[model samples]
Target: MDKSAQTRRNRRQSATFFTLGLIFIVGLVVMLSNVYQLDGLTDTVHDRHAIRQNTRLRSLQQFQAAGGRGVVGEARTRSVCIFARDGPAILHVKAVFERLGYDIRATKDDDWDVLWSLKSPYVAFGERLSKLKPHQKVNHWPGLGSVTSKSDLATSKLLSAPVGYRLPKETDAFRAATKANPDKMWVVKSGTHRGVRVRKQVDNVLKIRHDANLFIQEFISNPFLIDGRKFDIGVYTVITSIDPLRVYTYEEEILLRFCSLPYHPFDEAEVNKYVVTADYTPTWEIPSLVEAYNNFQYSHKQALNLHLGRQGHNPKPMWQAISDSIREVMHAKEDGIREIVRKRFSHQNFFELVRFDFIIDEKLKVYLLEVNMSPNLSSGHFAPNKWLYEQIVYNTLKLVGLASATAAHPADVSKDERDMLVSLRDIQVASDRCASAECDDNCKPDICQLCQLCRTPYFTDSVKAAFLEHVNRGNYRRVIPKPLEEQPSTVDVSKAINSTQNNHLMTMWFRGKCEHDKTWCT
Candidate 1:
């Protein structure tokens, strides 16, 4: 009677077991689907993060290349070669590059192609500043330097000359004329207005053309007096970048160069007996000094007239001179020069730093002197002083993004705290004197004691002569000469120390202009 009931119960139990197995299988499929989706999401996030990091790295590299990093100590991307002979300019760049942790390769090669090929930022022209017209452009900073270009010559009569006639190789006649009329005012026709100390030669004129590879300028009469010694101003400026180039006169130094021999005052009896009595202006009357100078030049021939009243004005004093407006003008001009250089050359590796040299006449007229790409940068030279080198390091670091004011001591001070400190300093000093109150003035400021302006300074030749004499006396000193590769074995000292074979190192005749002469390099 119970057989049918037992069979139905067994079937029921089997059905329940099968139903539980199906539910379990469905749950397992759902869990596997969720796991796969999660894995895909994780991979997508990782790829996005990788892309972001790559973009960030590229951006940082770009900033470094553009000198946009705001760090104080860092490294540069490549080595830079400074092609200079002497002075502080080269040292400053070298020191700064080292401080910034860069791998530097210094060279004195006049071949710019080698420099460019080596992947340098740009070669610094470390000489005097040259004046450029408002519309003119330069490769780097123009007023602080000059770049070689056919276009810069369109308006520059001095730059536009016969290929072989740029700067005349000889100043013999001019020197003789100056010696003949020791006190006469003369025209120095070369790169810029230097100053007149002798009369212009009527027949044996020294005409400076563009291809002479020399710096030529007109030498105006400097009649100002300071303690009875003649002096000139050494204005310091810098051009940071060429593409959007900038120029600035961060410092000025005055040089009081007394004549090698001083003159005695004429006696009263001597003055009364002369047909052409000398009219001397007292040092106090600055304007009268100019008038007296002009009066003396009136009747005499060009050479004699120029030298007429220079005797009384001989012993001038050292004085730094520049207006605040001029400083600003110089800075603006620097930017203009950079923009112009970029537009003109369209080559990124043309030039960088330019130190423009200038000399002012008694009339306070500013005249361009010469343009230097490779300025002097030995320790004694002002350009490579410790302070300037520090700046170079700071800029290089900022470019590389390795160090910054924030990163250096970031843990010690909060960003707000650091900013507040800077803001407070800005308030205390004001914008004009923020760098330093004395710095804003025209005093002769230089790098170190070695470069301190001398009370009695020697001309370039004199310095070279004195240095050579010192060297001949068994003195061991570093002297920059033409690269050993360029000079003959007799002129090169690389093989030996104090080699007698290279005793008389030949100096560039007129300065570094011959080296910069475009045709010569070609």
Candidate 2:
């Protein structure tokens, strides 16, 4: 009775042990792979941001698990009143923000500490905008004429697109609009489309300006191309404070958007897409377009490498160039932006996201395409060939000092306390001080020469200092690059951030059982 029974029992135990061991090993491998990013064979969507977000999430969880409190006691946290605009990006923003532990609401009360808005900074100053256009305003700003305090950017090695007609005596918008540069191309942007390049002809130019709202700009013809596709570098810039005008650009997530079609200067058919879009490729012409998209496209990092080889420059200089171009444009319209911010958005305090588009010529020179007011933060931006909207927004929130859930409670935040944070009235007091002559953001020797403050030496130095302060910063891995702390600690959960509309369901449920006899699951 013993031998045969004992052998059968032993075999059963062995099988059980083998199955348990295999499961343990599989689990261990999965954990290691996720933590170490060992999926090198294929980089999927999650690799772009999930890995980093998960790391941050785990760190936060571990901090709370370790008994550390976040933003507790008298430290106090803040809640932002977000007035988001309509679109897919904002939809993503609302979803991301709702998950966080804050009082996410829509309000214009004076007590709100911080305001995140999608409304144009100029909307409140529409009367002003109507009275004078962008070019018109730039031209008339005092001290912008030849007798100025600021030095020109071109004097330095920094490449910049020439801004025209700002000096009032020489200003004639019509003449400026009609005259063609060597590029022989003009770009007109009115309400919504990115922009359209027009040939140099007075009739064509007048027809465009007839819209009244149109901004006529010179379009660059000699652009650096990759695989014959026209592309631009999209930089995500954040303005934490406008009083001193703080702006930062993310270096790591610099997005490169390429055109769907090959770069052909004379091809009128491809104009709209070429006016600007890198995320989508044309699907027309059947097999050829599809085949072109498949073969021509590559990730931003890959494109960067290709561009680097083509330009023989490092990431540092390229980013520095891009940042310089942004500053130059800002210098040209400083007062206009400040007025828009002060009059319309003049809250006690707020934050803003500015998306700057730039194109490079075959000479590796950087040109500012435009500063997008309502930046579309869809999956494609700030990181080419990757979905990183979550990461981008997360980083922005961290930079803005939105404390974590552990810091404060929703009931704790009130409209009364927020009124004390810095308001436009407060800034106006200092505004004169900035203009009184002696403040500069972080101006350097190289940047000072490029400072427009020289042109308007009589104008406020505080603002120009901010513009000139960010020069010669060799490209950074990320514009606002800061890796997570080495060890776990309380992460500010006020860390990251929108929305609305609705639909309804009709009617009544009749309790009749069992036509199909189907039941719901647990």
Best by TM-score: 2
User: Which runs of model 1 end up more than 4 angstroms from their true locations?
Assistant: 1-89, 106-184, 189-197, 206-218, 241-245, 251-351, 360-368, 380-522
Q: After superposition, how far is residue 374 of candidate 1 from its true place, in Å?
A: 3.1
Model 2 lDDT on a 0 to 1 scale: 0.45
Please provide, for model 1 over 105-152, each residue's C-alpha lDDT reduced to its tens digit, 9 standing for 90 to 100: 455433221131111223343321132222112223333333323223
Q: What is the lDDT of residue 136 in candidate 2?
A: 16
Model 1 whole-model lDDT (C-alpha atoms)? 0.33
Q: What range of 10 consecutive residues in model 1 has the weakest lDDT sum?
A: 447-456
Put down candidate 2 lDDT per residue, 45-72, tens digits, no spaces. Answer: 6675778878877765665555434422
